[model samples]
Target: MLGNDLPPPTEVINMYKLNQIGLMRIYEPNHEALKALRGSGINVLVGVRNDELQQLASTESAAEDWVAAYIRPYWPQVNFRYIAVGNEVIPGEVARYVLPAMQNLHNAWSSGVLNSIEQIKVSTAVAMSVLGESYPPSAATFSQDTAAYMVPIARYLNSIGAPLLVNVYPYFTYVENPSDVSLPYALFASESAVVIDDGLSYYNLFDAMVDAVYASLEKAGAPQVRVVVSETGWPSGGNGNVTTPSTAQKYNSNLIRHVLSSHGTPRRLGKSVET
Candidate 1:
């Protein structure tokens, strides 16, 4: 949906099935997409727009209504997996409403309307900027300003048996600090280990970024909570050499291979979670 020339919802769903894409995460409640997803069998992680956070946090009923309108109707047919309350709204003004939105949405979902199906959990999506210190992965911690919001949200997600959704963009990290962040590491094309953190090895920037979030969660007293990568990609042609087609294809293919492999990240080896 981010592109200017995307096909219609039906065509898009067909392509997903044809390509065997198991899961999808949308940025907002796209009714056309929801309708097309019914009986499609592709797992879905739907997002609530950042603007919707204030309304959802304002009242429990508002949350319930949102679920009713965007989720309930498509139920088991849509294979709803998770409801993201907000995307990258933290470290800013509306950060105050993120947890409240999650709480209200959780209450609405657990209010017996959708009690029969506990699989459709509620959480929020955030960017890597929430972490103040991310290098060395293990030593990562949330920034002072964002901690007030992330800490509570982490605990809430842990309590509800839901995973925190994070948008980890190694490409941006590489471009921002090309002098330090190498292209091979950012694309997961490195042959040898890159960073060694507390006996854990990291060969790619993606793992480092994700582990940083995990470290932040643990520091926030929510070590048990999981993380789902809500968004990640390499630009196709926006920039010059760094955003060429060759690099984009390599990054996308390597990412898929890395995720499908049996071995997970250094910090979470042998443990699997959705990407």
Candidate 2:
């Protein structure tokens, strides 16, 4: 959720505790949000913007300085687990700077300044646009044009044991091709029959999309790199079978149940997922 949508930072943390939300992702390291989250016990994944990539990528010193300024001040208290180097950056804009920026940030985290601190995982968020094909949960492949940028990024994430973060929105798919993608499948409801592809049955569009990303990672020769859904939600108000409040409720409720079940996707069963 965007910081603006929430109440004051301290109240936000209180609300999260009240709701039992174990983890939250903040797009930027807003001082108030970080400060409020301090000692709240809720985990956070703070982000670095594409605009800041150039600055952080310029020098190792700059990356270290960023860590010093934004991260260290709210250390063990905030429970910040990951440093998202960039958000939805691939195939359209800021593609070139993604990997280099990640490397510099990771290097900075590993430097002596933060050596005692648990090394925060460094990664970038990618959109489904990076995939050339994402159907059947088996034929997904990285776009050829993005290979130069994606291959190295995948390899680096694999080596560091960091998951590949990708935003998957079934809402967009249904909105774009409502005639083909049914509302039930998109909403994680049982109104529709399961769609079988490559001998695997897909009861929900979310699993299919996630598995498609796994297949793409395999095609990129980064099969060891785990795929994590960085963002996914259905809008409460919009025209269409999938975008209504009822459908959104069903989708979100079922999504929560599916996640808490800890039963991974059909393609990678038994593997736990991080939202």
- Model number with the top lDDT: 1
Q: In model 2, which range of ten residues has the least summed lDDT? A: 1-10
Identify the runs in model 2 with alpha carbons over 4 angstroms from their true place: 1-6, 191-193
Error of 2 at 221 (Å): 1.4
Where model 1 places Cα greater than 4 Å from the true spot, the runs are 2-5
Please, what are the lDDT tens digits per residue for candidate 2 over residues 69-151? 89889987888777888888787567788888888888877767677665578888988888888887799888887778888
Model 2 clash pairs? none
Give Cα distance to truth, residue 105, candidate 1, Å.
0.8
**Model 1 score (lDDT):** 0.89
Instruction: In candidate 1, list every pair of residues with a backbone clash.
Output: none
Which RMSD values do the candidates have, in order? 1.2, 1.9
TM-score for each predicted model, relative to the true structure: 0.97, 0.94
The residue-level lDDT of candidate 1 at 123 comes to: 88
Model 1 weakest 10-residue run by lDDT:
265-274
